[model samples]
Target: MPVIEVDGLVKRYRDVTAVDDVSLHVEQGQIYALLGLNGAGKTTLIRMLLGMITPTAGSVSVLGAAVTAGARSAWARTGYLVEAPVAYPELTVRENLELVRRLRRLPGGTDEVIERLALAPYAERRARTLSLGNLQRLALAKALIHAPDLLILDEPVNGLDPAGVVEIRTLLAGLAHQHGTTVLLSSHLLAEVARLATRIGILHHGRLLAEQHADQLDQHRRRHLHLGTRDDTAAERVLQAHGYHPHPAPGGGLQLTDEHALARPDQVATVLVQAGVPPTRLLTEEEDLEAYFLRIVGADHG
Candidate 1:
């Protein structure tokens, strides 16, 4: 059975439909990413699935149990860090983990998690004294304290430094690889999500726009060619005439779409060459999750 399943889930707030009929499945031992901009309802969907909020329509299930009825015990085997976790300022790093251990009555020591997150250095320091980066590390340790089977993290890497980011990435990889955990994480950082997620789900305007295997998504978005031209406008016009709207790129080039475009690569190259464009300078751009994300969500600096 899939670790998590959402079928036609909907959550509405007065006049606004926060989540509109989103459905997806996450299999066991896979890292699934829920991605969207702020106010896109990714959080709402996650909250509903976790039983933290009530849905206006449809259903959600986690670990083969109905979300509403079985959430309390179903979540016992789950560990989550939502957005920036709130910890008591007076509590020390180790104290926070102790509190969680006692609250959940789970087995095992917290040392493994503390060491994994590198929170040992600040273990005795009060949570309020830690930097934002360190605080995030402490929160991560708390989430994994119980070593739950399923981990749900919302923006787990937020406020993390480069080193911290790499550490969390490695830790997450180990969670799925070594401990056999299923993870569903949400993030706005496409690059980080790309590295950690095995499957990706894209959300826009409170709906799932796309979902695919990470490698397949990359393959589907791979560029056919990067056409450089002395007359960039002419190159774009030529592409437009063939019903292709290539994304704009610097140095008078166009970012070609994948095979879905009507014009063949040879035809496109020939057209660019005929239009005084330098086909000699053509090169293929390596596909990444960011490219697929930008295409689906459109370009936004924020």
Candidate 2:
């Protein structure tokens, strides 16, 4: 069985469906990320996975055990962080981790985790006094203090600085690749997810719209030729005269998606240069994960 299995999982609130007919599987050592914007039901689906909220329909299984309201078997084997990080405001960072360790009956690993997450500096500092970034690190520390088999995080990089983001990314990657950990996370950070997740699932409007391997993502995103010249108006006309259709890009440039234009951008540049417009910048640019995500979700909404 996969490390995590979500079969036809769904949730609803009155007349509104928060999640709809979503099914997915995560195997050992694979980092699977759910990609969606806020209000896309990513949080609701995650809540169901952890059995924090009962599903309106469908089912969820973790570590080969069915998730139930009272089921605690898989609870000890999983680490998760949903939405904002919380801690006992009166407790020191070390004390908070100790609390988790004692509650979890773990032998010992607090010191290692503190260093691992670069939390050593704040280990003795009270949670209430920690900065937003440090507070987030503490939340992650508690989750990892148990060293559970599966780690589920929502917006894991929230409130983190650039260096902190890189640290967490490296930590997750090392856990998956080296320690055989199965990680399931949700994020709207498209580029970061592209760099990290082994597989990605797109959720929008309470539905799972698409799934693909990260390595194969490039082939799926749209590719276009972008042209920037001294005179965009003349550049657009010149491209059109050369049997190419040009559309205004979001960044005030011309975007051409014709097979000919993409296949031979140099030729298009030649045309633009000869036409007195003179190409300032010309390159074939493929849609990044963010663009692809917006395109897919926008198409669904439209």
Candidate 1 regions off by >4 Å?
69-71, 222-224, 227-280, 286-288, 298-302
lDDT of 1 by residue, 1-302 (tens): 99999999998889999999999999989999998888778888888888989989888888888889445768788888876778899989888888889898877767877888898889899999999888888887877887788988888888888988998999899889888899999987778887888999999888899888776765566555677767777778877886777877765567776564434677777767776664555666665666667778875443
**Per-residue alpha-carbon lDDT of model 2 for 124-240, expressed as tens digits?**
899999998998899988888888899999999999999999999999999999999999999988899998999999999889999999998888889988878888988888888
How many pairs of residues collide in each model? 0, 0
Per-residue error for 276 in candidate 1, Å, reads 11
